[model samples]
Target: NYFSKNPVTGKKVDWYTDFYYPLLNQWAERVRMVTSPDKLIFVEPVPNEFCPTSLAEHQPANMVFAPHWYDLNALFAKAFGDFTVNVQGLSRGMFPLKTFYWGHKGARENYTLQIRNIVEKAHDSLGERPVLLGECGVPMDMNKGEAFETGDFKWQARMMDALITALEQSLIGFTLWNYNPANDDERGDDWNGENFSWFSRGRALPPSLLYYEQDAPSLDNGGRILQSIVRPYAAKTAGIPIHFQYEMNTGTFTYTWVNSTPNPASQTYLKGEKSVFKPPRTGHPALMSLETELFLPSQLAHGRTVIVKGLDPGDKHRYDESRQTLFIVCQDASLDKVHSIVVSLDPPLAPAFAVNDFWGDFGGTITSILVAIAAIVTYFFLL
Candidate 1:
């Protein structure tokens, strides 16, 4: 609509020939005189000066750049510069923020270009330090005054994909705006109902959607789903590092180590010495270190290694949902056996297979059984 203009008919052609060309030539000349070929310089403030707590909380990621608030920009004009703090809006939520479904309207494209320019200038001024365009997303819903639009789901995602692609070159990372979908209203209508969450209200996650939440396990009790172990059969040599990670589908469990025999098989079997380990509470991954000597059983003549894992019980609903896998690099040739150690990787509680294979096998078996029963019942009734 904004692109519309009158058709070039007889009178209009004359007007264009006279007025438009001369005006365009004059504007071009003026632009050339004012604008330089050199790029604009943009300086970014040091990261922590804006929000001390947030900077402390955000973990290091390979591909992302987090930005400070608008006011903090002046502090970091020079590299490694210290800043005077001006704190605002730091504590608990002051009531709730209104959800405005301001749809993308006039000048949206122009606005995007303006933001792009700012990012470019900032990167040029700061010298490249993983310069990413952070915080530039419209809500799914908006108020009347806000120039944002709520389009179909596919379209929004597609548009975001395009924007992210454009940003990829200069930006090392991107942080999507506030993830908390709760705008303080149960109905969601107060905030246009659309800007809240990736999830829809009411419908609990279906079984089919479980996979996305399963892969990353939480070290703490909010716990992750117990991902199934598709391949049960595993082999381990002695002692490189016994790698094991757990998922708390049914809350967290304490890990205990036992050694049954003296050989490889015995290493898998926690037969005699019982040792339980309660892993520390952590949101981020923490390396575990437990040092103790093991008793070697003579029958197999090999030594035994031990490991333990534990999770808190409070996080049951989501934590108790999955399985854990233990892997070892085989440090000791004398000890080859690795079993599901209340903490071992071998001899998992359920059968273990590759993720894809496990899914296929589980689905196929269920389908086949149902079909067989249906056919048998039909034949009997017909007879």
Candidate 2:
């Protein structure tokens, strides 16, 4: 379908090789001519197309391979199931039946494998450039808009979690599909019956109060599937990141990275800071003193315990409450050693007493007091 007839020779020509690739190279050149060297150019892949080796020949410096992926079954059916298709291998003439996944675990594994495959292919074809998942998200109005009527977005949350977990496992950055203020339940994004926005004007309220007007103001507004969207991540690292994962059910987050010595050349001039510094000795590995920062959401960190491993003695970790950031001063003796940080919910000391339990106990105490007062009043009246 992508083959084009050569106008001069009246013969079929490979569109990607003869036309699309040249156009892409020319476009990149034009962009580089106008933009600064530091500005990164994101090259998008053609639909179902991998990063062709031809592109690597003309690959520009500071360029990123940005591709989009989605669960085609969920996108088209407006629902999520235990099955998913292997959309990545389709371009390679791989059989879809051979790539299909069946159970819940299989579906989740498929997402991870697909994303990892993209990253690997990008490295192979485009060198060591960063591969960003340009777009990824789920349709909010899945299952015939049942979540909108019930005010329960568990399905949406699960789908979003699975997608993000895959991205984390693949260790690639991503910009979620959308965040449109004009999105409503009925019209969606106002395009093609699609609803991918994280924020929606239409409230996901129960059917009983779907149209009910409120006299007083409400604090809860907008934001859908926030539990999955708002998550903890390594905002900045002093070294190379090895791996990171978050368990939504357990509110556990773990991140590991190799400790790296601070580069004096990269430091900016600040008040009262040294302008010149001596380089580290060549014979020994330089000790890392830079801080590795992680963005830990306060909501998740409220009752969680943070554990830092591979830190030198006397080196301490700090959590800035206002910024919701966990900073670790990694001073590992060896640069080859990996440092790890874990934040997990603390185990309960006793049986858990939830908000419902508190309310139930309060109600029971009030009822007992009222009965005692009534009995005393009756005794006085009889006397």
Report per-prediction Cα RMSD to one decimal: 24.3, 16.3
- Model 2 scores a C-alpha lDDT of 0.70
Per-residue C-alpha lDDT of model 2 across residues 1-78, encoded as one tens digit per residue: 336677778788976668766777778778868986567878777633557777787666678888888877788788
Writing each residue's lDDT as its tens digit, candidate 1 over 125-175 gives 332234444454433332331212322333233223333332332222355
Question: TM-score winner among the candidates?
Answer: 2
Candidate 2: list runs displaced more than 4 Å: 1-3, 32-34, 89-103, 204-220, 260-289, 303-312, 347-383
Per-residue error for 362 in candidate 2, Å, reads 43
> How many backbone overlaps does candidate 1 show?
59
Off by over 4 Å in 1: 1-115, 142-151, 181-196, 203-383
Q: Residue 89: error of model 2 in Å?
A: 4.7
